[model samples]
Target: MKKQYIFAVVVICLTLTAFLLTDSSDTIVKYPTGYRNWTHVKTLVLEKGHPLYEAFGGIHHIYANKIALEAYKSNKKFKDGSVIVFDLLEAVNSDNAIAEGSRKVVGVMEKDSKKFKDTGGWGFEGFNGDTKERIVKNMYGECFSCHLSQKNNDYVFSQYRK
Candidate 1:
């Protein structure tokens, strides 16, 4: 009788474990319909003499990546994540325009551009493109407020501009 009782207890434990793992309430993905367009985008390289030259005067190719995570405003789905790209350029030293150096850093970062303004659109957690886990959730601020310290040149290091 003891053996039978122990067996029954084991069965109950296994069943409970399975039910907990399969629970959908913990990982429910929620988002509004017709909100996928906010996530698709392409990189851009501003050329000289362009209307946006002042903003991207010496900017060259802009490298960026995309990921999906839970949305902050409306959507709470991991189907969307924030995409971040760094703009690399040959910047002129602030003291002298004739001096040149490479500035391979982020000038601007767009998170969930497609779904950025969408209600229920997911927001990004982090973007570390160096590793296979380029995008992950539950990390980094939705917006990088630390860059506010660089407000001298519109939040971008203008020292690199020619």
Candidate 2:
């Protein structure tokens, strides 16, 4: 009877552990649909001479969904369902003009209070230009660490500019 009880408890614990792990992984953020059609927040150019140019050299266009825009405009902590997209493209120079070139990547930030509580209620992902392949595999180590510095701003780096 004692052996049977111990085996049952172990089995129950293992099942619970498996369920919790699966639930967490299932909460991984999915690619936002029609993000390109969202509101354009701003555009910036990271030239070759800039300090972060090596890692992020390009033309960056920031976009925010309705949910995110509201929070940004209100200057409040973003709530769940808020999403921000960072569209990065190469910078093409022609004569004396510089313009956006081919896309390089699309970095995304999604806010879900419960799903991403460990990362300040934000999930980070970087998809390749095509938006099909995810380039960022580790959110906590690669993305969250940097954004953690901006905890006061709700782990967000960009500010809504007009």
Candidate 3:
């Protein structure tokens, strides 16, 4: 009977170890401070019927002190300016590989006259070393749709349209 109990404990320990090892690789850490050459862009002016009127678009209403930080990295550059807007959410679960509610999304916008640009464009999905996988997807459908109309105005639709 004692041998059987020992065997079960060993098996459980091994299984847990395997799960922990496999889950760690999926975690990623992100921070806004990593971006270099930071600057403050003009606060956005949101008009009715704007495509970004949905929840994921974030809170609307225009004021100079809306608190958006913009910047370009040293090594990376574009003809106009590779604009990036980022927001850091409060961390939730710090210990687990899969943290719930600890993450951020960074939007990258590049100016283009001919092509429809990302108005609040491509998002860089980030997570802080958790089992939840960090994903960065191109928001071509959501962000690009609005910028297409702003072709005459440098493909940005918000108040800070280039």
Which lDDT values do the candidates have, in the order given?
A: 0.39, 0.89, 0.40
Candidate 1 lDDT over 1-162, as tens digits, reads 999999999999999999998795434222222322334233344546789576445544333233321222223322334432343455564664433246433333443434433322323232232222323333224333444454443232222111
Kindly list the per-residue Cα lDDT of model 2 for residues 1-162, writing each as its tens digit.
999999999999999999998885568777877988999999899998999898689999999999999988998989899999989999999999998899898899999988888999999988898756888878999889989999999998888888
**Scored by Cα lDDT, where does model 1 land?**
0.39
Cα lDDT tens digits, model 3, 2-113, are 9999999999999999899778333322333434345544343223476743323332222111123131222222333343443322234346542224323444453332
Better of 2 and 3 by TM-score: 2
Worst 10 residues of 1 by lDDT: 153-162
TM-score of 2: 0.83
TM-score of each: 0.28, 0.83, 0.35
Residue 49 local lDDT, model 2: 92
How much does each candidate deviate from the true structure in C-alpha RMSD?
12.4, 4.1, 14.6
